[model samples]
Target: MTFPQNEVRFEQLSTASPSVIYSIEEYPGRPARFDYLSPAFEEIYEIPVAKAMENAAIAFDTFHPDDLSGYQQAVIRSAKTMQPLQHEWRIITPSGKIKWVQANSRPERRQEGVLVWHGVMLDITDRKQTEAALRESEATKKQILKAIPDLIFWMSADGICLDSMPSNDAFQLFPDSGRVGKNLYTVLPPDLAEMRRQAVEKALQTGDVQVYEQRIMLHGGFYYEEVRVVGVGDDRVLVIVRNITSRKQAEIALQESEERFRSAFQDAPIGMALIGLDDRWLKVNPVLCNMFEYSEAELLTTRMFTMVHPEDRSILQQYIEQYLGQSQTKDKKATQVELRYQCKGGQIIWVRLNLSVVRDAQRHPSYYVAQIQDITQEHAVNRMKDEFISIVSHELRTPLTAIQGFLGLLNTGIYTNNPEKTQRMLKLAMDNGDRLVRLVNDILDLERLSSGKVQLAMTTCNASELMQQAVDSIHSIADQAAVTLAVVPTKAQVWAASDSIIQTLTNLLSNAIKFSPPQTTVTLSVQTQTDSVLFQVRDRGRGIPADKLESIFGRFQQVDVSDSRQKGGTGLGLAICQSIVQQHGGNIWVESTLGEGSTFYFTLPTPDP
Candidate 1:
């Protein structure tokens, strides 16, 4: 084909352009053919321009299969509208390389109802790849912001909220929708806003991250937040806020628990101490110091084993070793033992020591905790109980044995042959039976009074009448002992249980008469006092020892143990008397001297005259 001079100039100008310049003619009901192609067409589509011109379908074949349909439709629409066409599509070159291209063309209609397009096609694969990479980077940034629990903000240096990433409502101090385009002063409290403003200024000036913490009250709950402000250039800053409420609460709870433990350890009533593995006292409470008669400073300076009784130190050491060994295999149990401790004053005391090991995070024994309780008084009481049991057994057996023997003799024919002997035996049996009954009754009476189980009935009783009644009751016993009974009574009246007071007097008189020698005078007297009436029983006989005066009032206690058998005494009369006097809100005591007379005195509350 030959071109005109103007057409040749147009072709020459298009050849220098880095684009494929082409022309296509479409006839009605026929395939389209290329009228021209630039030299760049061979470089872009890997097809010769001569081949493309002869058959435009040769260039169309390079269109990617997926895009060819849309390309043809665009052409048809452009031709019908006679408008400029702008389209972008993918193409596969003859060399099997895929590329992106953009086409711009103008369409015209001829007189024969034919259509033609003059267009430029440019390779845009690099630009397409760059745009795709940018889109992927934007998507990844969004995902990262979504996963973070912190509320992030892009703000101007003046504390204005420029933009914010989406975050949980709990982290947002205010609704996210209204946060942008607002100043921090409007979004937060005055104090918090001031704090953030200062931090923002500091971060921008120093170009370093500024960190702080704040407590916020929202929805009637306290929230703790850790804030970080960092300058992001251009007079802007990035603010990160993280909720730290749970962590702050845990730390506060731990501190409170530690304080409570320390208070409890220091103020415990019983002795408490902390011991190191070497048996040294790491900490000692006031009670432990008082118990050992040592100061807290002194105790801490000394080892625990040194204060332990020599005999018990080895045992405590062994227990510690065993506990540590067991902890290595499994959970260890606390151990308790009763041991003796030597006080600072050289006094020995009994204590119940409870010991347990404290373990570290790795479950290794760290130290020990000890609780000590004084049990010295308990030991003394137990010893007294044992002695009382033995004395009572012997006292009961003596009377029961005599009664049994006397009754046996009377029942047997050996005593029946003599009526006088049988009657004597019968009398002996009756007397022994009476003694036994008195012993049991005295025991019951003392027990009831001591335990506060018996309530005494109080009444006004004349002192002289009480003395006469007691003397009359014990007159026969006094006569048998060859002791003279004397009464120097007064008209004093006492507020007491009449029956119980009379019993008390009778017991005192009986005891005096029993201890008196032949022809000794036993005096019973009463004296009036300011608030009480004092009664006295005096005897001139073998007096009670000086040491026994106080102890003689105890149950089963006498100046001599043999008194229970030889003196026909149950050893409980004085104890019962003391209980009765005490129940009447009075006191009882004995004044005596060895080898001299003895006097027993007791008082009863006096009734108004």
Candidate 2:
């Protein structure tokens, strides 16, 4: 076909355009034909323009099968109404590739009853793919927000709520009507609003996330929340709030329990300690520090085994090993042992140790807890009890054997023929019986005083008179021993039981006289003091050994074991004296030199003025 000069120029311009520029004509009872087609049409559909112009059906065949019916309907409507057509539809290329295209055109009627349309068609495949990807991304974001339980908000920089995605109505702070345009100051408490304002300002300024915690009351209950804010753009922020009430309550409960345990550990009466796995002292209570005579700082820096007595450390170590080797089950019992501990001052003391283990989640040993009770006094008492039983048994058997043998012989008439022999034998047996009686009496008296069963009748007495009476009572014994008794009298008054004081003085005098040499003097004197009267009995006799001074006051204890048998002493006189003096709130002690003498001293509280 030949075109006019202007038409040729228009066709040349259309050849270089990206979009296909075309014109088509339609006649009644006739098919449509392209009056003009740009070179882009051939490039877009991979078909020759000459072929498409010869049969417009060549172009119509490129319409995707699914879009053909809709495309035809849109064209028919636009033709009847002579309206502009603006539509997008899918088309397939001659190469079997599917693509999207947009058509924008206007229809006009010509005088010969022919309809004509002029427009541009664009291949919008890339643009359609981009739009599809955007839609998919938006759908994915909605699904993710739906799955989370946190409350999310897009807020403006001025603390206005622009939009919100609440996981549920329970977490929504405001009604639907109150949201969107509401300010935080109206929706939240004043203090909470201020806190959020500060966080918002900080997030916008630094472009960093601001995180904080808030406790809110909602629906007549308390809720703890963790809020995080981050700048989404220059004028807006994304806020996320998570409810953490359960976790926070658990933490608070754990902290309170730890505080209670600390108080109990510190206030316990028995010694207690927490030891680390390395055998070092992690914590020590006040009682433990006092028991070991070490400060808390000293104990913490030292290993636990260092304070244990050398002979007992191995035993403690073995016990710990055995305990750790066993599985820690819920029904397992704590391990206990009695061992000795060496004090900081080098004194050894017995302790009953109760040990328990603490474990980690994996049931591995983490640390140890120890409870220690001082048992030193208990051990000493037990030892004394055993010794007392043995001594009493031997003492009673001796005199009973002699009395029984002599009586048996007399009853058998073995001495009936000798009157003088019988009399002597009878005297010996009677003497043994008297000794047995004296032993029994002394035991009963000592027991009564030791057990607090004997309550002394206290009275204000003259110290000089008590001394005189004690000396006089023991004067016959001193005479038999040929030991002189002298008294340095004092006019001091003592608040004491008269009979007990006299007996105490008598026992001291008698002991002195027995150990004194012939012609040696035994002096009894009293010295008055501010709050007490000091009584002294001095003798020139074989002195007590220094080591035996303290033990001599115990029942059945004596410096010379044979003294009880040879001197006719019951070995309980000094013990009785000690008990009596103690009951009167007095103290008794002895000072002795090896060969010179021994002086026994006792102090009794003076009578109240």
Regions of model 2 farther than 4 Å from truth: 1-9, 25-35, 42-73, 92-96, 111-113, 171-177, 217-222, 262-279, 282-286, 304-307, 320-334, 337-341, 351-374, 389-553, 558-609
lDDT of 2 by residue, 1-609 (tens): 456987888867899998989888989788889998898988888899899999999998889989989987898999889899888898888899888989898898998889888999999999999999999999899889867777888899999999887555565444345577789998889999999999999999999999999999988987788999999989999988888888888988899999889989998999999999888999989999999899999889989788888889999989887877764555258879889988889899999998899888888888888899999999899887888888898888888988898889899987889999889888888888888998898899889998998889999999999999998898999999999999996789999999989999999999999999999999999899889999999999999999999999988888987997778788999999999999999999999998999999999999999
Tens-digit lDDT track of model 1 for 170-210: 65665578889999999899999999999999999999999
Q: After superposition on all CA atoms, how large is the RMSD of candidate 2?
A: 6.5
Q: The CA-based lDDT of model 2 is what?
A: 0.89
lDDT of every predicted structure (CA atoms) = 0.87, 0.89
Q: Report how far off residue 197 is in candidate 2 (Å).
A: 1.3
User: Using lDDT as the measure, which candidate wins?
Assistant: 2
